[model samples]
Target: MMEAININHFNRHKITEADIIRRILSGEKELYEILVRRNNQKLYRVIRSYLNDEAEIEDIMQNSYIKGFTKLYQFKLEASFSTWLIRIAINEALARLKEKGKLYHISERAEELNKNTILEIPDKKQLNPQDKMIHHEAKQLLEKAIDQLEPKYKIVYMMKEIEGMSLKETALALDLTLSNVKVRLHRSKEMLKDSLFVISHDTHIFEFGFSRCDRITERVMENI
Candidate 1:
């Protein structure tokens, strides 16, 4: 019983990203699976924002993981491992977009988009859904609204709101200025508020299911 308890304790102790990177770099390549599983959901949403096709998104995901794995030695700890990984994924998605001649109309016109972008998050406590159906409907409406936003704003919003990235991290991943990230996030929130006309917060958009997660990780492991 004591030996079993020690084994359970060792397994339960979480591995930090830096530690995992070190292990993978030191020849324990299987440890890369930990990083893949940890960031799969965020990577899916980030890449999906650029490409709508499910198959293409999965392809970009697998490619991004393989790219990051090969370039792991170049990773600097100045940013979180997740942020570094997000940067790679975003670059991969944008490359795929450019190749397909569907590059977004991303401009540096923060000044133009900033106009009337100062909408408030209105009191949403009154609009809470009481049941699952209402919640699902509200979520769907919110997602449709987000889908309508410009790429610049949508990416900022996904990184900040959906993935819970810090402002600095989002800026780093998107290669936008800190001020740009803030302005675009504000505009994105306002757009959602205007489109939904009620609640402005829904945490269920662009869900990456377990099956897809396993599939992407498996492909990456096989290729790596």
Candidate 2:
């Protein structure tokens, strides 16, 4: 039923990094679709954690791929292609957040970490509908709660909770002291928990974009 190439019937058994590079350099621009399809879900989860707008998610993702392709020639054998691409994606997603006024308190979170600030969240159903209505609602509530956080906490939440980046990676990315990242992450999670439990009807901020993007992923997969 797939409208595209039968990936299962590819003449080649695997797509290695060298193969991808060769294809790119040989002027096979459309071949990049293989890479895009392979990485879409991974990239989506990365974007979803920090952003709620599905269309904007597509915009940012498309932007990331463009940036990655342009920078492909600069890639080295030091890191896997996917790792390098993910770094590019994360940077793009963060930049998108900044442009949308989601990033705030740009300096305070860089302060030394204290015992007072840390982010924590209880287990909650994510995109799964059957997980529990209250918990599903909690996820939406959490997004709204995040919009209210100071830039410091927001960045930490975006990096840790959404992107699942290790603390070391996050610390390096934000140029923050390790403790600072941890503390802010803790505070952000706590705030989100409190917000999600309150049951908000004004959840318009994340409703539309997320659903649409989710649909896009489904369509792409079903067709491929």
Candidate 3:
């Protein structure tokens, strides 16, 4: 199929992020689509970690992408593009929070007051319709619990656990020390009920699906 051939062609000549940036800077503006498609899910997760409103999240994502494109010249090739982009998205989220007077201090000591707990859900590969419904409900419960966590822990959880970023990458993106990243991740797990951790790995949570992905990609491409 054409899709398979395209996939093969892409794999055979995969471009590095830095290379894409270089080409984009050199006037191959269309290459920016590659970056937008690649990082859409990540940007969504990071922004969602701060604000729950879907419309607002998409607005901030658009602003972040436009800002990133305008400031692309300042981006250093030595650094991770995703990390740099995430920092911008985080800043945008924080600014929105500040505007709404919702910005709050993040204190490690405050997290210490919460007791550790764990919740488990059944995991089965082949499920009847009833079992599938139960699984869906369980995942929803886990998502709600994650949503209730303090912003400090929630962002770490989103990046490290949901997004599957390395501890170092998470630290770099968040501008936290490695130990701080580890501590926050550990604390996030504790607060989430360790047993529910299985669901994160097995199922998609906080998904940014294909339709939305295409919309963001098209919009960013249009503006940039």
Q: Rate the local accuracy (lDDT) of all candidates.
A: 0.76, 0.60, 0.82
Q: Over all chains combined, what TM-score does candidate 3 have?
A: 0.88
Model 3: per-residue lDDT, tens digit, 1-224? 11335434544698788888998899877777777877899999899999989999999999899999989999998778999999999999999999988899553433433345444476667598877987888888777777877898999999988988899999999999999989988988877655676677743788889899888877887887
Clashing pairs in 2: 54-209, 104-151, 118-186, 118-187, 119-185, 119-186, 119-187
lDDT of 2 at 72: 75
- How does residue 61 of candidate 3 score in lDDT? 93
Number of the top TM-score candidate: 3
Task: For residues 1-103, write the lDDT of model 1, one tens digit per residue.
Answer: 1243542343479656677788789998877777787789999888877777999999999999999999999998778888888888888988888998878
- Error of model 1, residue 116, in angstroms: 15
Off by over 4 Å in 3: 1-12, 105-120
Per-residue alpha-carbon lDDT of model 2 for 1-224, expressed as tens digits? 22245533432578676777777767765555566666665566556555657777776777777777777788775655655776787788778778878654243433333435333433443535555565555555456556656656666676566555688767765668899888887777665544343333233323435455445544443333
Model 3 Cα RMSD, 1 decimal: 3.7
Model 3 pairs in collision: 118-193
- For model 1, the local distance difference test gives 0.76
**What are the per-model C-alpha RMSD values against the true structure?**
5.7, 7.9, 3.7
Query: Candidate 1 clashing pairs?
Result: none
Consecutive 10-residue window with the lowest summed lDDT within model 1: 107-116
Superposed Cα deviation of residue 186, candidate 1 (Å): 0.9
